[model samples]
Structure formats: C-alpha cells, structure tokens
Target chain A: MNTSRHTRIRSIAVLIVAALILEVTTAVQYYSTRSSVASVIMEMAQRDVSTINRVAEVKKIAENALHHAVPEVERLFAQGDRDSLYRVLQQIVREHPELVGVDFACKVGDDGKRDGYFTFRNEETGGIQDTIIGFDYTERSWYREGLKHNGFWTEPYMSRYYVILMSTFAYPVRNDKGEVVAILGADVPMHELSAMTVQLYENMNHSLVPVIGLQLLGLLLLGFIMFRSIRSVRRLSEVSAEKDLINKELDIANDIQTAMLPDSSQIHEFAGEVSGTQNVKDCIDIAGSQVPAKQVGGDFYDFFVRDGKLFFNIGDVCGKGIPAALVMSMTQAVFRSVASKENSPARILQDMNVIASQGNSTGMFSTIFVGVLDLATGRLQYSSGGHDRPFVISGGALRQLEFKPGFPIGIMENATYWDFETEIAPGDMVMLYTDGLTEAMNGEKNLFGQQRIVDAINASGAFETPKQLLDTMSQAVAGFVCGAEQSDDLTMLAILYKGNSAADFPQK
Target chain B: MQITKTVENDNLTLSLEGRLDTLTAPQLEAEVNGKLDGVKTLIFDFQNLAYVSSAGLRILFMAQKIMNKQGKMIVRNANADIKDIFTVTGFSNILTLE
Candidate 1:
C-alpha cells in the first residue's frame, strides 16, 4: 500500500516537471522566433534605407563635379585649344576623387563622327592618365546617347582606361551658335555600392546562426525528457503487475494454511448459541483464532477428537513469512500424524522435536503447547516445548499453569518434554496462546503483557463459551494495539470443560 | 547496532550495544560468519544491549550451534528484560548465561 502511494507521488512529480519544462521550452521558442523575425526585418529595412542614402550622396557629389567641369571644357573646345581641353579634363578627374574619369567627344567635319580624349586616375600610382577615344568612338552608346540627351546617366560599362566598372553622367555641350557640338561626361565606379550590400547580407546571416542552433538544442532536451518519462512509466506498470501476482499467490497460500487446520465451522457451532440449551455431557466447547501480520503467517492451531480424547496443539515458528510458514505447516503435519497413534502429549512432543532437530542447519525453531483432554474424566494432560504456559480460569479466578522449561523444538536433538496434569471442573476454561499475544505492541511500544491477558479473561466473564472467550481476547489485544501495525502473527485457542455427568445432559 | 570485538590468544569477545532486531542482525552475522577458526572460547557481552526479536535470536542460535562444535559460548550481562525473554524462549537451556 505504501509503495503504490509513493509511486503515485513520484509519478505526479515527474509529470509536473515535464509539463513545466514543456511550457518553458514552448514559451522560449515562441518569443525567440517572433523576436528573431522582427530583428531580421528591421535589419533589412535599415540596410535598404542606408544603402539608398549612400548612393544618393555619391550621386550628388558626382553631379556637382560634372556641372562644374562642363562649362570649362566647352570654353576650351570652342577656342580649339587641344592642350587646354586635355588639361581641363585631367583637372576634373583630379579635383573629385569620386569620379573615375572625365571625357569630351567632338563631332568633326560635319560627318557626325566623334572623337574624344578620356582622362582617368591611375589608382596604384595616384596619377592622372589620358587615353584617346579614336577608334569608332561614334559607335559607342554613351557618345551617341550623350549627344541626344542632356544631363543623362548612362548604363554602366567597363572603362578601358581605368579597367573598372563605371557609369557616366553625360551633359551635352553647345557653341555660341546654340547648336550641339560635343558631349562632356563624368564617370563613377559602381563596385563600392555593390560591395556594401554584400556585407550587409553577410552580417544578417551571421546573426541568425545562434538562434537556429539554440532551437535544435531545445528540441534535443525535450526528446530526452520524453524518453525518460516513457521508460519510468513502463517500469512503474511492471512493478504494480508484479505486486499483483505476489498478492494472488499469497491468497492461495493463505487458503492452504487455513485449510490445514480442523474445520472451525463445526467448532463455532459447538461454541455458539447451542451451548446454552444443548447437551453438556462428555462435550467440550473449543475454538481457535489466528491472525497473521502478513498475507501468510507462521502461527497455527489444530484440534480433533479421537478415542474420546481431544488432541490439540498451538505453535509459532521463530520468524514470520514463508520460511516460518513452511516450518509451521510441517510441524502441524507432524503433530497430526504423531497424535493419531499416541495418547501422551510429552511423547508426541518428543517425537516431533527429534524429527525437527535433525539436519536443521538454518537454526529455525518453533514453540508448541500440546494437550490431551479426556472428555470422560475432565483430566487435562499437557506439555510445553518452550511455549508459554496456559491460563486456567476456575471459580472466578485466573491462574497461570506451570511446567518445567524445555528448549523450543528444533533447537536440540535430545531435548525432552515433561507432562503436567491438571483437573478441570465444569464451567472452567483453559486459554493457550503464542507470545505474539503478550508481546503485541501499541503505538507507544508497550506490550500487552500477561497481566492484561488475565484481566481480559476475567472481564470477559469466566464462564463464557470458548468462542466468546477467544473473541474477547482478540478484542482486548486489538484495543490495546489501537490500530498499530501488527508486527507478528497473533493466535489464541480456548477449551471450556462442560463436565461429564450423564444426568446433566439427558442424552439429547 | 554496534559491535566491539576483542581478541586475545584463543578467546574472542564481542560486545554488543543497541537493539539487535531484524534490521541489525545481519551486521552481527557478518562479523561472526566464518571468522571463528582457532578460537577456543567465544563470549557475548550484552551490557548495553537493549532489545532482540526472533530474527536476532536466530542469529544467536546460529553462532551457538557453531561454537558448540568446537568451543564453548558464554553470554554475559544480559539485563532483566532481555533475561526474561531468554528464559521465556527457552534459549536459557541452549545458551550459557552469566
């Protein structure tokens, strides 16, 4: 009972812990997921806004530099000064570091063909370098498109002079005749903006790595708890199943133990209401009671009337449980077989001791009180083998019978028991019990001693029937124990002598 | 349960204190299990011993049986309560008490 309760408590605790862990893990996961998504979105938005602002700032700087150089180059071209135009282009490239190059394309001989001089910074030497746009310069899209559109930003292309990706801001130039003559342009490198965007995406990926790893760890922990809980539940069921099987076996054993004794139903009837009106001649009222602390116990009592004599015995093995129970049953069988042929309780005990003591390596022993009551004479012959001396109640007074002590059976091979005789009158009772009665303990650890036994018999009324007498003793012990757990098997046997006068019974 | 052992020559004395019920009988059993070789006398001193149950009696019986084969065993200083138990159980016949 206690073990199952403890298991229940432990199971509840485990479930609560599991539930708590699950709740914590789910809450952490939900909040982490939400916050991580929000962070990623916020990072992307910031990156987009910053990238646009950077590009716009660079565009404004390039536009300012280009507008500043357009007029100088146009004035130099109108003068037809090639050196001054070249110097002006080189100065534009040097003045604004964001501009990769500067160029001027002229339409010559009215054929709408174009040639231009491009000046660019040499990145490694930090020097200005010039290249002539002499080969099919009119076929270039920037040159053709620049002539048609003013202040146009051209598609990005590879700069042959600077060997880098570049985009041009083209401004058309005209002479004092207000006719288009040439196109002036400023070029900017495109790699800077693209590299910044790549860096932003790389940082976002780095930030998500820890979050993904933490989610995996949480999942592993949950799996481990699930496995442990499953295993414990399986083990708990197995234990309960095993307990049930043991209990079933004990029930069967208890049945066998009870069956081994004489049928108590007849004894109960003899000691029941019939005692007040039925025949009292040559008849004895006897009853036995046994209560084992466990499902099966080591205490026993038996009685059978044979050849006009009542042969009876009560015994308790040294220990409780199965080992003691095995000895108890064996002893009972020995008593029955020996008493069937012998009339002397001493000899029966002697033969039993001899048989029990042989090869008793485990040192197990039992205390027994054997008796023979002659129904005709009311003479009782009894023997004690390390057993408690019985109490005889006569004339409203209870007295303990005395006998010489002998070692408990199975302890010494040569131990001898002596017979003690006592005469019983009509309306007298004899009580026999094991030490489990006197040694029974209460919650305070105090024993229900021999004095209490006498008092209980007295208080129960000396002339009560054997069954009522045994019941009174049982109630007394139970009351004294006060619901404390029984520590040993308690047994009691009562035999009431009703006298043997033929005139008292009338043969009914 | 506490057991104090004193061995001098062939005489071995074990002083036991506290209760020797079912739970602590095995401790005394382990101490005397197979260590009695060459001993001519065994003495159990129970001056401080408090209580004993049937399980404890079984252990004492085992020790007495062993010593009976080779030597004599003596139990000494049992209190009134323990002596009553010994007398009632008839252990007084098999065991020599002082």
Candidate 2:
C-alpha cells in the first residue's frame, strides 16, 4: 500500500511539470503573436489614415474650385462671354485630373433656347473634349438638384462619356438679382477611391490570415488553460481599444490646431469694428488659407489690428506633422505676444529668435515673414527669417517685395533681423506664401516651380479683392498638382491695402 | 536613399545617393546619430543626391550641432537646386559647403 501511494504521488508531480511547460510555451507564443499582430494592424492603420487624408484633401480642393469658379462663371455668362467661359472650363479640367468633366448648364431662356457648354476629359484618347451642351440637360439630376440646393454632392453614377463611375459636386450660380441662373457641375471619378478601399481590404485579409491561424493554435494550446486564454483575449481587446483612443486624440489635436489660427471672418469683423470707431474703413482686405498635407501641419498665419498698425505674419516650421506643429504653435504665440507690445517687425523677430533658440536642443527652426503695416501712410515695415519674399501687385503689375533674408528663427541665439520698408498704394495687394506653393510636385516628380507661380499670378489678371486673388492662386496650384499627394503644408496670406483714405480707390 | 559610409583614421565620409526626403530622412538620421564616435572630421558627398526636404534639413542640423563639439562637418558636390534651398533657408551660412 506504501508503494502504491508513492507511484500515485510521482504521477501527479509529472502531470504538474507537463502542465507548467505547456503554459509557458503557450504564453510565449501568445505574446509574440500579439506583438506581431499589433504591428501589422498599426501599419495598416497608418496607411488608411494617410489615404483618407489624401482623399479628403482632394475633395476640399474640388470644393474650392467649384466655389471660386461660381462668381467668374456668373460674371462671364452675364456678359455673354462664352469664350472666357470655355477657357475657364478647359483650364479647370486640364489642371485637375480628378475632375473628369465640368458642365455649365444654363437655365432655359425665355426664347426656349439654352446656352451652355460641357468640357470633359476623354479617357480613351487621353485628351480634353469640349462641346456645346447637346442633350436636354434640363432633365439631368445635376442641373435639377443643383438649382434646388445651395450646393449638392450627387450620388455616384456611371458616366456615359467616360464609361466609368463618377460623382459630381454641383453648385448653383446666381445672378445679381439673387436668381439661380445656371447649374455648375464638377465631375470626379470614383475609381481611384474605390481602388484604395480594395487595396486596404486586401492588406487586411493578408495580415488577418496569419493572425487567425496563430490565434487558433494559441486557443488549442490554452484549451486546457481557460483563465489564461481569456486573459489574452482581453489584452488584445485592450490594445485595439487603445488604438481607437489614439485616433480620437489625433483628431482632437487637428481641431485644436485649426482653432488656433485666426479666422478670416473674425479678421474682417475686427476690421469693421475698428473702422466703426476709428474711421479705418477700407483700410485693408486680408485673406489667408492653410491646408496641411497631414491632419496637422507646421504652417501658421496670424493678423490683428493694434495701435493703427496691421501686425501680420506667416511662418513655416522645418518639418511636417506633430513636431513641426508644436514649433509652429509656439512661434505663432511668441509673435502674437511680442507684436502686442512691439511696433517694429524686426524687433519682434529678434525677440522671437532669442526665445525660440533657448532650449531648442532638437535644432528645429522656422522661416517667418513679419509685417507691420501703417494704416495712415501705407508704409510697411517687414522683416524676414529666411522666408519667401512676398509679392506686391500695384497698377496691374506684379513685383517681388525686396527684403534681406535673415537666418531662420531658432538656429542661433544671436541671429539678428532687419526691418525693410516698402510702400503700397491705395489699391495695392501683397501676397505671402510658403515653399509648398512653388515646390508642389506632380506625379512625374516635377516641381510646380517659381516660374509657374509667376505665370499663374500674371495670368490671374487684375485682382478685385484679396479673396479672389487667393482663390485664383489656390486653384492654379491645385490644377498644377493634378491631384497628386502634397508632401508639405500649403499656406497663403494676401493683404490688399486700401489706404486710410475713404475716397474711391484707383482700379488696378 | 543609399548611404555609403567610409571611415579612414579619424575622418568619416558618407556618400549619399537618391532623395533625402521624409521617408528616407530617418535612415540617414539613424546612421549619423548612431555612428559618430571618435571622429574628428565628417564629410557628406551628395553627387548623386537629387532632393532634400525639410526633414533632411533637420537631420543635417542635428549632425551639425553634434559635430560643433566633436569636430567639423563639410557638405560636398551639392547641385544648384540644393544650393538654392540652402541659400533660402540660411543654411548656407551655418553649414560648410564645398
């Protein structure tokens, strides 16, 4: 009976050791598999974020193009300037590859005749085809719905011309009497976006197979160890939950970055209030836009009126995304705080450099252009921190505003900046932009270049307002890029000086 | 980006080919930050380099800061476009270009 008890005890010990070994091996496999799966998911998530950002960017560009073209289209059509309308339509489609076609469907006139045109990219021949509206476009949904709504995004439908799936952004053009005169439709192919979705699905499936196989094997090993398997599943859910939290935080950060910049409407309202109290009406017309390649970018612009001077600045940090965004925010804050007490742009830049250079161990730097415009005399005192020289448009001529390019901020503690003076007439405009404008790359890796910028500005004709000119320039760049992904933030600021005089200004 | 590193005595020469952009800047950053040890002189050959983005500039700036205490760094064979970028960013004043 003692020998029988000894054998039984040994058997129990052996079973315990085997169970321990199985548990340890299963735990190791689960840990490694979890990490690998996490990494795969992380990579896939990153790609999805980037692709979604690009898709959103393309949509925004298309919307802007439609919005900007409305006024021009209305004006041209009112004047019966079909030639200009044709040119505009061709330019829009030629520049933006995403725009498969554009049509200006006019409202049937009192004479039972419709004057409209359609310009489309012929996918088979790889050429743009322009023709007068042939069919009964009055029955088309784009025309009917566009006239009914302020702006509409049409459901995806197969394009009869290109024989591909296309969606359209339809906008109604109004006459001076507030009557809808025509419907403007911009078509975008759905194939590219659909292809991206398909690619993402394929990637998920490729990564999911191994993950599933590993999980199955783990479950088989842990079938006897119920508590541990449950714990592993719980940990995986926690990891995925953390990913969702991270995505939400990133979106919040993007929103905060956008909120930090001054809104154009706020600037205008502030101008109005100042003019109401101080007789500074028509002193300045300012507009600016910042489009980040990613959700958050390192480009910033700010303008505020204080003590009869318009303190405005635009800056670009020497990188992209989060790190650059941090520096951009700091630089903008420093500029705003310094400009509050400082009257000289050079001094503000100097103080900014000193502050930024301190504790800048990461070697991050920013190129900034600061301007303090005197509303009374139209005298502008500007300083540059290795930034692009702004352009002045006066008397229907374009010229670069000359300035000494100083070292970018945060490079050296002792870097000094100099203030240069320039005078803008009663009806002059100044344009400031970052390198993203000139260095925009197309699919062929060719830069949009400074020459293209000059050409676009020159071709944009005489500017009536800052917003119109800014829109024209933006459209030009968008067209030049042809829907390629931008690698940097595109920021632009335009200020039209109307002088302190309330007199009717000279036209450019 | 391809980084060909050659060390002779106390001097180090890294010849670069292709683009130094957002995607490739980290690779070069790792190479520079991880390997600079006991080197008195460092040289960057950019004969085959085609482009350099702001990220590339940041990496170069970091390297310059490190070499300021250890030794000197020189950039060689930069094309006109690269020179234009340096001139605009004021990096020409800070970096030794040849």
Candidate 3:
C-alpha cells in the first residue's frame, strides 16, 4: 500500500484494537456495575422478604406458645398474674435473638384498662423486665393494629414499647367461649441486618472486586499507550506530507524555469521566418545555456529578432531558488516587451528598469547584457546593466569590449544606460557570460576566472559555430570545478555573426 | 554570510561579513525589511565585506529607497575591493556611501 493508505490502515487498526479493548473494559464495568446494582436491589428485596418471613416466624412461635399454653395465659391474665406470659416472651426472645422485645396486650374492664405488660431485654440488668406495664398501650400503633388484625403479622416499625426498629408478630388469646380477650406479640429489631448481608455476600460474589479492578488498571494503561502512539503517528505523517509538498513544488518550479529559456531551434526558425529569404539562418547563429546550483535558478537568456535585428540579452537575477526564478521570468518578460518596440539597447534597458522598479518589493536586480545585431549591416550595439564585458574573437585575435558602468536594473528608476558598438566580420564570434562562469569555485576555493574562459575559447576553434564555443567554455568550467558543487547560476550566450550582409546574399 | 544587527535610537546598524552574492543576499534583505519602520537612519557596516554582486547592490538600493522616504541610509567602512564593485556599477548614484 502507499504510505497514506498504509498509515490510515495502521491508525485505523490501532483505533480498532484500542476500541475493542475499551469495549471489553466498558462491558466489564457496565455488566459488573449492573450486577452489583442488581445484587444490591436483590439484597434489599431479600431483606424485605426475609423481614416479612421473620415476622411470620415470630408469629408462628407466638402461635405455638398460645396453642400450647393459651389456657394458662388467659387464666393468668384474668387473675391479674403475668409471670407465665413474661417467661414465654423471654424464652421466645432468647431463641430468636433478632427480637428485642415481646409482650402480651389485653383489655380488662369496662373502662378498657391497658393491663398486660411488654417484656424487653434490658441492657443494664441483662434480664427481661416489664417496662411497658404502666404505659397506656391501647392508643399505640401495635395495640390498635393487633386489635384490628387479631392474629396476623404487622409491618416492621419503631416500637415505642421496644424503643427500636421493631416489628411485632401479634396473635389473639381467646377464652373458652372463643371471645377475644387479649393479644400476644413479639418485637423483632433490624439492628442485625448488616451481619446478615456479610454472610450472604461471601456466599454469592467472592472474586468480583479484584477481577474487575485489574481489568480497570489494564484499560487505563492500554488507553494511555494507544493515545500516545496515535498522537506521534499523526505528527510524523503531517511532517512528511509537508516535506513532500515542498519537494513537489520545487520540482514543478524547476521544470517551469528551465522551459522559460530561449531554445536554439527557435533561432533557426526565427532566422528563416524573419529574413523571408532562403539560407539566411547563417546571418546570425546564436546559442546559450544556464545551469542553476539549486533545482530552480535565476539565470535566463532571451532573444527574438525584431525588424531584421536580433535583440538578445543574458541575465542573472539576484538570489537563487524559487524567488530568484520568479524574478528571472519577470525580467525576461520585461526585456522582451521593451525590446519589441524599442530596438536601441540603451532604451530597452532603461524601459526595463522602469518596469522592474515599479513594485520591486523583494529588492533583487538583474545583471544583464542586452545586445542587438543588425543582420543587414553586420553591426552589433549592446548596453550593460551592471553586467560584465563580453569577449570578441575575430581574425584570430581576442579582445574584451568594455561598456560604461551602469546600474543593474530594478535598483533605481529612470537610470540612464549607454550603448556600445562593434562590427562582426565573417568567422568572428562574441561570448557573453554571467559571473557564475568567472566566479566558479574549485575544491581549493579558487575562481575559474576570465583567463580560463579566454583560454578555453582560444583552445576551441574560435571560428567554430556558436554552440561549439558555448559547449567548450561550459565543459572547461565544469572540468576546472570537478566534484565541487556549483554554488551559483551559470549562464552564457555565444553568437557567431555570419554571411556579411544583405548585399552578399544578393537576390536568388 | 553572517550579519549582526544593532538598533540604537532610530538608527539601525547592520554589519555584513563574507560574500553577499546570490546565495546570501536574501539573508541581508530579510533582516532589515522588518526593522525599517520608524527608523530615520539605516547604516551598513561593510568593514569585513570582501565581495558583493548586483544582488547585494539591489538590497542596498531597496534600503536606500526605504530610508530616503523615512530618513537616510548609508554604507560605510567598505574595503577597497568591495568599493570597486560599487564604483564600477555606479551604485554610488542610487546609494549613499562613505
């Protein structure tokens, strides 16, 4: 897979695994918490059910006592004797420790005197006592409820008689005529509930806490690791993507910059079309080349004949790389525009300066040698814009044609430039170059200089075609600076003026 | 190229070292582009400058233009070889030098 797809899959895989792990943790926690809650609810409901069951148990014991000793209880109650009923309640409480108090409640006279006593487990005495004997228990909830139900169990509540969260299991004591005379009750408190659940929990859910706790710890550790890994993955991908975009843009810029230069085949085409006569391509043979140290360079050479004159310029824009490349194109366009209308080298340079300085915010300039060759006269007039001198080779001799020093274009608006002139005989050549050639550095930091350039031109047949001269010079410079990175944009333009003039070619 | 910058009052001083050619000219231009505001005087200390191309001169022209509208700009302490490039290019006309 490609890197982006691979990275997406990796990230998605990581997320899936983490999500699965998280899902396990969440499911474990959710189910465990749900089970715990269910257990709590069950425990609570079980307590309520057991509470009801215990009330029934107490009623059964009371019923059993009444069934066995009802005759004695009624007789004693009628005789105003309570020792037997007190012994029975004490026995029931001792057997069922959940019960804190038990009593026999009854009515005695026409005024309805509350007589039977409530027996409680006294803390100070550690014995049964009749603490509720004198209290009027008829108006209370337990007595009123006991009278109403007569024999059923009552809901658990705080019994004023027992002074605890208690319930009474009450049943009626009937005389021989089956007339209800008194009620028997047993009070049970819920203070022992906590002890009951502890036993119930050990029997039901023993290993749940530690297992769920360990899963929680694992979840946290895995979550942290996954989060960190994903963060780093995203950061790495972003950086690589940015780098790729920049490299891609540089490649495009390099292609565009290289395409912007003047091509040699164009000259042959221009020569044929402009002259409108056969075999006039020999009148002006021109060739040039540029190589940037970086992928994109600021060196450019442009030439287009206007009205039978070859107007050409070679330039090195300030700076390098993308910024320089942009400036280079702008300078090339400006030169073409100005030279089309104005053929004078000086006027073209001046007009270019005006255009270049208008919104020149980047503070870059082009050092240029703008030259125009008259195909009819074999005369060349050129202007300098802070550019180096060109060398002319004719009649087996070489000489540098120097021009007046001028400001490089884009430095100042309305800067004046002056044109210089020279004549090219048959077999004569002109070599124009940027500083990249002379200032080319070697491994030992020595410049190739003008001497090597002149020597290279002389070594090559100076009378050869323009392309030969350029190739020879470039090869010599590259040979001198072998294995050393070229540190600047190297540009050179070579031209061999030919075929004398229009008169020499005569009419076909 | 190495450039050291110092700002005193409204004057910004830039000290240039090594060759200010195609590769290093932007370094100088970017340094002073932001600091040109509210500065009445801009100074270029070329004491250690050995070589300058038209690229370097272009930066000088920009600074001079910006300073001309705000205050004044000048290049001083230029060595003989560095001065010769300025002299030959007639950069002296567009820029003020000492």
Candidate 4:
C-alpha cells in the first residue's frame, strides 16, 4: 500500500487495539464490581438474619422464665396473696436480663376491696407492685390473648416509655374451671440488632476504596503511552516535510543555472553575423544530428561582439548540481568582465585566472577556450586553459589545432595563458568541444575519441552552416556511445572562416 | 548613452540618460573609472535611463566593489522595472539606493 494508507491503517489498528483493551478492562472491572457488590449485599442479608436469630435466642430465654415463674404466681393468687405474686415477678426479671419489664394483670371483683392483686414493673426503674395493676385486665391485648389461648406472643412494638421492645410469650394461670384469671408477659429490646447492621455497612465501604484506586492508576498509564506515541509521529511528519522542501529548493536552483546558458537558436543567430562571407563562412556544413541529454550539465558557451571583434567562449565546470552551477555563473560573469576590458584572449584569461583563484574556496576549477575572430583580417586569436584543442577541417582533411596547455582557471593565482594564431584560407573550420564528446563511452567501454570526431567533421563534406557541424559531431558521439549513460558535461562550438565576400563561395 | 556629471566640493553627481545596456556599459564604466579618484561620494541619477541589462549590472557591480575600498556609491531615481530587478537579484541588499 501507499505510505499514507499504510500509516492510516496502522493508526486505526492501534486505536482499535487500544479501545479493545480499554473496553475489555472496563468490562472486567464492571463484572468484578458487580460480583463484589452482590457479595456485599449477600453479606448484609446474612447479617440481618443473624441479628434476628440472636433476638430469637433472647426471646426463648424470656419465654422459659415466664413459663416457670407464672405458675407460682398463680398459686399464690389462688391463696389470695399479693406479696408472693410480686416476689415471683421479680425473680423472673433477675433471671432474664435482656427483658426490660414483666407485668401481671388480674380480673377485678365487684367489692373493690383488693380481692385480687396485679403487679407491673417500670422497665427504667425495675420497680414492682404498681397501684394501677387492677386496671381492667379484659381490655389489655396480652390479657385477651392469654384468656383466649393457653399462651400467646405479640409482634415487636415500642414500650410505653419509648424503648424498642416486644411483648411476647404471655402465659395464663387458670383456676380449676379453666377460665383465665391472671396473665404474665415479658418484653425484649433490639439494641444488639441495630449495632450489627451498622458494622456491615462500614465493611462494604472499606472494600470499595482500593478498587476505585486501581482503576484510576490503569487509566493514567494508558494516557501516558498515548501521549508519547503521538509526539513521535508528529516529529516524523516534520522531518519528512523538511526534506521535501529542500528538494524543491534544489530543483529551483537547477532551473536558474540552466537559464544562464545561451539557447541553441540564440547561438545560431549569433553565428549568422559571420554568414555570406566568402572564404570564412563556406568552410564546411556538418548537419542533421541531434542528441538531447536528460539533465542540464555544467557546460556553457556564448558569443558576443566586443570592440569590433567576435568574442566566443566555451567552458565546463568540474562538477554538477548546485556547486557546479555557482561556479558556472561566476565564470560567466568574470569572462564578460575581462572580455570587455581586454582585447587579447591571453590577457583576459590571465585576469580571469586571478579572480577565480581568489574566489574558489572549494578547490574546484574549470576548463575554458576563449577566442576572438578578427573580422578585418580573417584571423583567429585564441587561448586555452587546459581545455581540448580545436579541430580544423580544411581542403577536405580535418586536423587538430594544437596549442600549449595552461593550468585550469582557479587553480593558481599567477597562471599565464599563452596565445596562438591561425590563418583561415578559403574554407577551414575550427571545432571546439569539451571532453564529454570525445570521452563518450559505449556499453562495451569503447570511447568515441578524437579521431572519430575528426572523421565525422571531414565526412560531412562541404556544409552550409556551423550549426550543422556541431549537430553532426554531436550525433557521431551519440552513435558511438550507443545508449550509455552520460557521465560528464557535453559542450561544442563550431566556427567557419568564410573569408571576405559571399561571391567567392560555391552555391549548394 | 549620455552621462551628465556635476561636480560639487567632494561629491560627484552623474545623471544618466538613454539606455544603459551592453553597448553603452563600457562608456559608463570608463567614465566612472576615470573620475573616481578623490571623490568621497558618488551619486548615480537614473532619472532618464530606460533599461539596464546584465552587462549594465556588471558595471554597477564593479562600481560598488571599487567604492567599497575608497568611498560610497548611491543610486537614485531608479525606475520601477530596474528597482524590481534589483530586488529580485538581492542587489538591493548590497547597494545604497533611494
């Protein structure tokens, strides 16, 4: 997949995994919390049942005390003794401390002369033999229940003094006729049950504290990991953007460098200035060849008129890309400056050498061939800086115009360039080229070489224009290379000395 | 190309007219090189000048380089096109202009 799609997929996968992990953890926590809460509820219910059981145990003891003591009270009541009944109630109270009070109520006779005695105790004071004991036993609930059944118990209720208690386990003392005559009952309080419920609630709260704490810690760690991953992704994106920006800048620099060279059409237009001259222009026509390189190379050539002289120069910097581009611009500027000031080719190169040497901090250099064609004399005065010698095609035979080589520009401060002069007869051509043309290699590592170049020029025979010569030479180099990659900068310049007038030349 | 020179006490004001191109660049270069011995300041008035090519720019570069050692050079009354070219090429950063 493309990088954008791949990154998106990876990000989505990470998010899904993170979400799934978070979801699973939440689910596990939820289930665990549910179980814990359920257990707490179950424990609370068990505590409630245990409290009820303890209350039941206390009620049983109160029932036994009432059952044993109520009979002796009834026996004393049968003998009409009130003091003995009171003593029996006091004894029951001492045996069952959980009971708050015990009371006895008796049926009233018509004389109202204390014929029957009833005793009741105040739970707070534990005092017995109250005067209100004869207050209509038939109207009391415990009395009516005792009268109806042999024994009965009441639901839990608050005492008259506001204590939480229950009156239960009432016992009836019947005379020989089996009619209920007296009733005995006991009351139990619920303080122990309330204390147990409070303890259960406190335990449930304590168990939940650590569970919430652990969940918070887990969330904190996940947040930290996500933050770090996001930061790293941002840094990578910034670096990628910076690299793309730098590449775009290099492309712009390449365009600016290419703009500095003269176009092929412009070069031909400048060569037109020498056209129609008799012997100077009709030297040879080498035509019908073209090769387009992929990238702009570190080669340059220009021709301009200065001081009634035709000044032309072809040069190649040592490298390619931005460094080479900078050097090429500098060389062009210095050449223009020195050409305008000096008439001799040698003096111009000497001046350029000094300026270039001072400015070239990278130790890079350039090879240049500068020439001035004198229109008045049909003479070419030239100088070379370690550049290739030009080839002269004359009388249908091509040969090299050999000259002494000087050091390349920017290599030494005081380097001297020697001048040479060549006289052009009716038909002679001088072809100048960089090493790229001669050194071009085929797939088998065979070079085009200088001889092949000269042969191509001679074979073109009598040509019409200088462009034809350059084009033919370029084609010969391309054919020799045969699809091999270009490893150096290619440049060429051709000049034909046509002598004085167009009448001396033969028609095509 | 026409260059009108007005010499004051220590400053030289040169008003340039017509086109400052490759053909006329040498005339200006020679004029400045001839008269720039003792002047403390040189002013280039481009009120009537129409165009400046790369050749013209080379002369300006030479003038600036020369002035850096001895005196100061100021360019005034530059038309919009020339000013735009100077800004694009970063010459505005190197020269004093008004």
Report, for every candidate in turn, its global Cα lDDT versus the true structure: 0.82, 0.83, 0.76, 0.69
Candidate 2, superposed: residue stretches over 4 Å from native:
A1-237, A272-281, A503-508
lDDT of 1 by residue, A166-272 (tens): 88887788898977788787888887867877887787787777778778878887887788788778878988898899899999999999888676455443332
For every candidate in turn, the CA RMSD to the true structure comes to 11.0, 42.0, 16.2, 20.6
lDDT of 3 by residue, A171-262 (tens): 67777677777777766565565467676777455546755685767768687867768795876679688778988889998888877787
Model 3 misplacement above 4 A: A1-231, A238-246, A273-278, A459-463, A505-508, B5-12, B36-41
DockQ of 1: 0.47
Give lDDT tens digits, candidate 2, residues B62-88.
888889999999999999988888887
Top candidate on DockQ is: 1
Model 4 residue runs over 4 Å out of place are A1-255, A263-296, A502-508, B1-98
What would you estimate as the lDDT of candidate 1? 0.82
Computed on C-alpha atoms, the DockQ of candidate 2 is 0.42
Give i-RMS (Å) per prediction.
Answer: 1.6, 1.5, 1.7, 14.6
Tell me how far the alpha carbon of residue A171 in candidate 1 is from the true structure, in angstroms, after superposition.
25
Ranked by DockQ, top first: 1, 3, 2, 4
Is candidate 1 or 3 superior in DockQ? 1
